[model samples]
Target: MNAKFMITPVVFSMLLLASCGGSYSSNSSDSTNSYGSNNNSYGSTANDSNKNDMRSDSKPMILTQKDVLETVKSKINSDIVVMLPKDIPLSSDSHFLSAKTTDAPDAYQVIFYETKNPISVNSDDLKEASKATAIATVSGKSYMTEQEAADATGHMDNVNTGMNGVDLGSNITGYTDAGAGSTFLNWAEGRWSMSVRNTTSADQQDSIDLAKKVVAMLEKETLPAPHQVGGMKLEAMPNKADGNIISWQNDKTDYTVSNFKDPLDGVKITTSFTK
Candidate 1:
């Protein structure tokens, strides 16, 4: 799986403007409502506690190596064991670290990066001083439907990067934004979504390369056979019409999962086996 950090467009522009040393107008409601008073750009959940965690002046969260390990182990619930590249460095600094899980449909992530000492988001020189860091990120999610993935990515224009050796003009949608010495890529195949961002030009290929590697890995892994998972009893079967299948039925309902090679582009597909 691929992982990328996302910031709102207004937030991105805000950073650019702030970097230019301009102050916001006190009387401007349009600016004050979104960016000034609430700062929704950083996200409403990113309350003062998160800000204090990123800034060095406040009390450190004091995470240990074991704490990081336990946090990762506790959240993982998938059978697929995706691996990242070898060279990405690891650190425990709160400013450059994050790990969490999202629900409704299950997902988990663990990310770590190393930067210079005394990292501070509020510092004037953050853009220049923290340009280089070793970042490693891993994420896994299971979606009940394609629309769920679409909702998360905001239905952005998906582009074919040809990173996975698919045909030209494949419909696999994605988003890419490059600026401030950084680049980000996000794409999905079926119900699975992946993202990668690189601030250091040196590691720009890391996300792309890892994405392809993951595609290759999942393509070869064994399928989840029909069995009892969570509380449902799934049964593995073959459908000559729809191809191979793993299905579940409980009196009133039925669910099926299957894989197919997307003819438009060869991005390995595991999708609901709908007729």
Candidate 2:
């Protein structure tokens, strides 16, 4: 069977940090506005009645990390595992926009923003109305096998001339690619191929050091094993003014944690999920 695993692209340059305090039209698609470089804008949509109800409330509705996870769980099949951060390091000002399944039935996503306004169940004007300090997402989808999933993460465009070895301490020797203001440290654990990147830094040592720290952490709190092979990618780009992103796969599902400021926090969020 043809493997259907694809790595979600990380578009850091186009991220918008705005408040979600404006009104949204109810006619927008359910998955139209979100925080990413996937050509989709960031905003919320709500019916008129729900909008009025939200406007009357003095305090905006706050959805905890657990709340969003539950919401996503309800939308997808119970057999498909979903993972998210146990606790986000953001302030209390963050508001959950929506949590629902994507175009695919087996896939699900949840979005939240660091804003002070309440997003209605149907609020549509989130793209132009809110000022958010940061945007984050937790998304998951199913795949066939770990090896096929791992192979899909290979990015031909990122190939560079500078290369070195990265020893992850488990007899698993990874490699580093440095060039064009970008550095990447890549390795594999069991059936999982892992990589950590720094787009703004070409320092090979920085990528290697961060990779070591992340690998040490994974040794203690492990991720769910994949059936065959899997893939994980972490990125740190402080100059983008947007959040960092971390993605991985396990069993038959591919998971992503995005819009975080720190790379270490991304790893913490990924390991927080349980079977």
Candidate 3:
């Protein structure tokens, strides 16, 4: 399966500009918003504090509402594209998920994703897609799996650098184009997943919205896409968790640490890792 981080723009109507006053076009160069009184960086439930379900830690993470807000706040101001929340822990039996907003006052981009075990793939590694997988067809590229989409592009040293939007990859079939911000990664459904959503960016509203969407999915505990490798309908190893069937990165650290308008632009990069 393919993992993807999405940089989707919030669709708003221009006719409502009189009440809202802004042309929300999808551009990467919009002036960022400030953490002012109108700051919607923190989700309404972000400060609830009582819904503590997965934040348990051994180091006693002193996570205060203010601290969480501040961390998210910094990402909002720094023009970073955060895909998940902060300090999310990864696990084998559980999935970690969160989202940060990247919509500057002048922008409205958001990233979304789920957690899974990272698969190891070498140059010769390739797995077929499954029916459960909802392929995304952005531009003209077809991402059969989420990982293919996640690892497509973006320097995830960490940020909202993956596939974007909901039910996005569903219509994508045969093939699609990778956007400048496209990225791919390997992920498992349960066993390999650990603190899935790693939020680190300078954007907020979009981050919050992404987080909400992820949390909403988490509430239902969405499973990974099933597999059907090599013309065979695989049953996901019986009881084992489902995740990216093909995944692996090279040992060559010659990676390009940068962002893009179309994530596919970086495909020219060659990895040092070989099978």
Candidate 4:
């Protein structure tokens, strides 16, 4: 993506936030937009970077953190990373987007959605349309000249832009049912996501804001009460050793690389891969 298009992941995620349906035309003025980042001791939840349209991406796809990061490295440039489900496009037509995932790991199974709900605009047309006016006031050529904007509705593809969403809080943990409620207070310990799409600006903002609240909760979210429950030794793979490759083709899960984190250091990059 270009620097002008370098909005935050929250924006894309928020785009498909709810069932928000903005009716953009083919003659809106140019718009400008900016933004940050987060993550986890995560178990690859569809890297749900911001998408447009209220798509359902809370499902656990067969993806790992390493696979996503590597894809970003190989395919995208060095600006920022906006991960989405393979169903949504990389455009400004809708409110949400999702990443692309495969059904059997190796096969290419993807879905992209182009929202019919843009306030419509032209690049050459410099009309005065702010994000706030997109809902009710903004319309076709009222915001821009005919030549100012192009049919930018097709900018995005390969993301699930029509999925649904719910909510999050400190109580939710792991992956739970989408219909449980809007706010899954017990989803997980780190950051959490709901299976519902937030389509409106307020809804998207709420989602992002809720994420922040969870991060705040992370500092205070209670850990499992210390008991006789079994636990594994807590250790980070060396930051400089070959990353452990957990995949299907290999007999074992880990195929450590030659340049993994330092052997003696207290960090490592454990990668989850497909067979």
Candidate 5:
């Protein structure tokens, strides 16, 4: 008997985003939002109480971009492509918070925080910096055979057929729900499955238009080549607060460009990685 592994890289990517402090609030102005809010109390000394509240025993080790990349690369043996933007937008003070890797399924993650304070990649302070502005992740497991991959792909096609709406070029399928104020686009390209999700828009056409823009942007880049192609799934919602997420998967690796506050930022990040 052969062992079978079922990997949901897209969902795993979402969980990683949440664990790293990605915000799902529709109200971008909310100071309490998870990812982009600058109201965190770190590095603040406005009052005596805050000064005393600072951790005295330890300080998070600040890391440069190169350091984080090296740390992540050192741990994983898989030749996975790590996608990241040339520059993180919104704040000049942003810094790398952590680089993590996991086995069994083989995964890696890199988090970028928009903060003025120094936070170690593996410290409690990193968790407190939940308003992380950006995150990039790759994860996946090997399939037993081509039949398994085909079955997974066929199942996904059947599952997502109902939500299909707009037709993005290059076989990309777009689904827009005006009532729910959400849009989801999905496709398979070059041994990879890709998707973009936005829950903040209400107009169906607006959502479709944005999906088109993202698809167009992805067309100009060179995507990672995996060992095999697998199944794809599509899901959407309107007025949801999950922000924007762009996720993709190859035969044995899953990639994500996420935690961005704006939909266009997601596009920028995706294109940057592929470029």
Candidate 6:
């Protein structure tokens, strides 16, 4: 069977991240973003001399069920799980923006989340908003050696600079920025990159508390696999009306991505094939 998995926007974002670097968006309009580039190991150098074309005739990459399965399998080992506290009175619109897994010998998975809590925002109440809004992203990576993992983390220095460093023991390390009202922290549980972040005017301590809660919740929760419809195990995503999201279809299945309370479980797949 000649099966081609249509590229959804989520998958496209993952591909872009791999080809380029990661990108982040926020609800804060006045927020200033910065990322550091290294010239040593993580940095790149320019080669002035050019040679003959070494390009080969390669077929366009097509995603398949096997590829989806392997990607989901890599996510099963991720040490991160996003679950907001019941007492926080969060918005029902909390959602997982995108998730992707790639098997590059060093298999890895990345998931992004956007969450918000109901709060009273007054123009004079706080700096940006009266409530807490954040984007929590987790990346589970497998490296060929411990040295590779160590080298990859070096870029984090640029991420944590100017923020107040928070020491949550040896396993968890992070920083809190009061000016930006953001808390960023990540821990390496083996090869997995687990992170918890809070971007709000809430206290730095609040961010730490949230991080602890996430770590505790993740200890008991396992990432859910993609949904299976008919005989094909397709990647399940939420529904969004904004037309900003991407949609895809295979010969047997079609996926319309959207925003929901949860990425994996929030949006229900209701198709003629699903009974």
Q: Pick the candidate with the highest TM-score.
A: 2
- Show the lowest summed lDDT stretch of 10 residues, model 5: 232-241
Please, what are the lDDT tens digits per residue for candidate 3 over residues 52-168?
544543333433323543454455532222221222222233432222334443222222112232221111111322211111110112244545434532213222223443221
TM-score of each: 0.24, 0.55, 0.16, 0.14, 0.48, 0.24
Q: Residues 1-275, candidate 5: write the lDDT tens digits.
A: 12223356666888998866645544544766544445554544355445556655457557775576466556655544444444434345554445345544344555555455654444455455363433433343344654543443332343235454568766777543323654455554545454545455434455556556656866775543433443323223332224444554455444555445555554565555543
- lDDT of model number 6: 0.33
- What lDDT score is found at residue 115 in candidate 5? 50
- The sequence of per-residue lDDT tens digits that candidate 4 reaches over residues 23-96 is 34222222221111124333322344444222455443333333533453343322222222212112353342
In Å, residue 95's CA in model 5 sits off its true spot by 4.9
Window of ten residues with lowest summed lDDT in model 2:
13-22
Q: Tell me the tens digit of each residue's lDDT in model 6 across 1-275.
A: 22335556668888988655433432333233242222244323232112112223443234332343344444454332311111111236341122233223333332222223222212122223223232222223444554444443321323334346666654555554333644445443322333444455444465466455544543544322212211111111122222111122222222223222332222122111121
lDDT of 1 by residue, 20-121 (tens): 654444355364465435656654444665775678676645554445545545555644342221222243434343333322234444343344443332
User: Model 2, which residues run further than 4 Å from truth?
Assistant: 1-63, 75-85, 91-103, 117-122, 143-150, 153-174, 178-182, 198-201, 239-246, 250-252
lDDT of 3: 0.25
Q: Which residue runs of candidate 5 sit more than 4 Å off their true CA positions?
A: 1-63, 75-97, 100-112, 130-136, 143-201, 230-250, 253-275
Q: Which candidate number would show the highest lDDT if scored against the true structure?
A: 2
lDDT of each: 0.37, 0.56, 0.25, 0.25, 0.49, 0.33
Which stretches of model 3 miss by more than 4 angstroms? Answer: 1-61, 80-83, 90-219, 222-275
Model 3, residue 107: C-alpha shift (Å) = 14
Candidate 1: pairs in clash:
158-173, 158-174, 159-174, 226-234
Backbone-clash count (model 4) = 98
Q: How accurate is candidate 2 locally (lDDT)?
A: 0.56
Residue 143, model 5: Cα distance from true site in angstroms: 4.3
